[model samples]
Target: MDEQTAGALPVFVFPGSIDVIFTQPHTHKQLVTLYNPYEFPISYRVLCTAPKKYSVIEPRGTLKAKCCVDIVIRHLGANIRSNIGVPDRFRFEVCKYGYTEVSGRKDIAVRLVENASDIARQASLDQSNFHASFPPDGSSRLSPPQYAFPSNPGAPSSQSSPWLAVVAALACIGALMLPTQGDMMPSLLPTYLHLSVPQKLVAAYVLGIVTMLIIRPT
Candidate 1:
């Protein structure tokens, strides 16, 4: 166990930044996740630099050991007039249970993203993430008409993912080849190139899954 002095300022791990987006006539919201990696239990409480600009749910709570918690931060009065040009943040204070001393502290920066293209990109990303949680057959796989929340940042990049699937497709073909067992066998090929029955089956299984994913309607 590490004893903490008042000067020691270790902090919990979380996304380094947050963005609150304002696109149209609606209340804007963003979510922040707090992570606790310690073995012992801890308590957390949040303070805002601009409290009137945002709403935080369950602003303080006990966090279990080695766990994660989601903090919903809604932009209060999220129209263009109120949130514009104002820099806001959430201040987090974490301390070990039963102790008054703060074990960790961090300040999270919040930005309001109002650009048109940026909002579209963010809405698309959020939809894709929601779809990913379900099976491939889920209707959410394609972007559906829906209200967008605070945008999540990931969008699948085509440059890397397709090449991986291509390799898997090739492996499926290679899996069909059998090891040279008789006089017809040649010595030129390396022994490692040979596919045993189990190896072949695994490759075939992988190919089947990828094939289905590729063929699925977008």
Candidate 2:
């Protein structure tokens, strides 16, 4: 949807993003979806940063459509519960009409400190957190508006970036076609073989494009 062509007034609402850290009972991952209301075009940036220090980790990149955006963060191999001592915070930066105007600048913060004891005691998993809020100053800071990741980690990693599927498939194919240890043919009949490298990549690109084409709130 073109922001310029969208309805007169602008409306935006997001349930917020998920943060997962691998550890303890299981691996965890979080996904956030957003709905956009505007008549002009827009570019959205989803960022997950260290709450205490924003620069510790730069904001990760993800694509957003004119009407909505989704963000996913994965906590890998280690128990997510381990991070109970640490808090995770995130921010969203949106540039619309090629930055001519900005819309829906928001932040989603998670508190691991308060919920740590419960997580360790029950060994229970929680995915609940705070309500999403907007910050007057884009800078990250401690405040009541912040939220916490409620559950221990559950997933190893966020799904690979949709854009990488194609390149990854091609890379795997090229690797397989090349000779391997002991001159092995590298299982040419592997299930992945059914999806040729180029074909797989093309399919991925199509899926991503289609996903954007059908962008809508869930």
Candidate 3:
């Protein structure tokens, strides 16, 4: 591991650099924020190089632009760890000024660097209202609606249904009546009142009880 770390530093390579190779398994982290101002649209990306010789083996998803977004590098594959090296690279690009295919390739790197500056500045300053609701006088308030909290909550609570409860109760009663092959006279409960798992079982018991009660013995 020591020898591998020593060789990866100072020299830079592309298409899976040393950091890309030796990254830890099942580890990742990321941060994102909105770049859309009232008029201009914005976007960004950040690439972090481990300060020490470590590889970022595999990343699950593409880093995207938006507020409160984060990325995590899940360390995978063989040997990997965070050691002394360059601070992870923060790469960002903005189309707020203007974007062209030619300009995109030519100025992409510069945009990324500037993007970091813009993000840092925004972070340091106090956050203002990104959204609001209008009042009767055409004035606005910064607070969100009260019901929004319940509409999409983090965890769910239990709910009850009366019809489902009835069905479950009947099912339990039927199971308890199983042992006697539905013998009506042997039990105090009437055969007609019993629920059988097999409909035929209950029907036969009811008919036999009725016939015996109605008929005369020889």
Candidate with the greatest lDDT versus the true structure: 1
- Model 1 scores a TM of 0.47
- Ranked by TM-score, the better of candidates 2 and 3 is 2
Give the best candidate by TM-score: 1
Predicted candidate 3 versus true structure: per-residue lDDT over 105-125, tens digit per residue? 000000111222343343223
- The residue-by-residue lDDT of candidate 2 on 1-218, one tens digit each, is 42211223243535433333333323244456655555555665444444222221113232345465554444442243456645455555555545534455665554343333444422223223222232344434423112222133231133344346456555644554543334344455545345445655665566565455335332
lDDT of each: 0.59, 0.42, 0.27
lDDT of 1 by residue, 1-218 (tens): 22211224465646655655566533265667888878978887776655545556667788898898988777754565555534555566678888877667665655565754564455444443432332332223222111122133232222465667778888787766646334355667777767677777887898898887667664
What lDDT would candidate 2 get against the real structure? Answer: 0.42
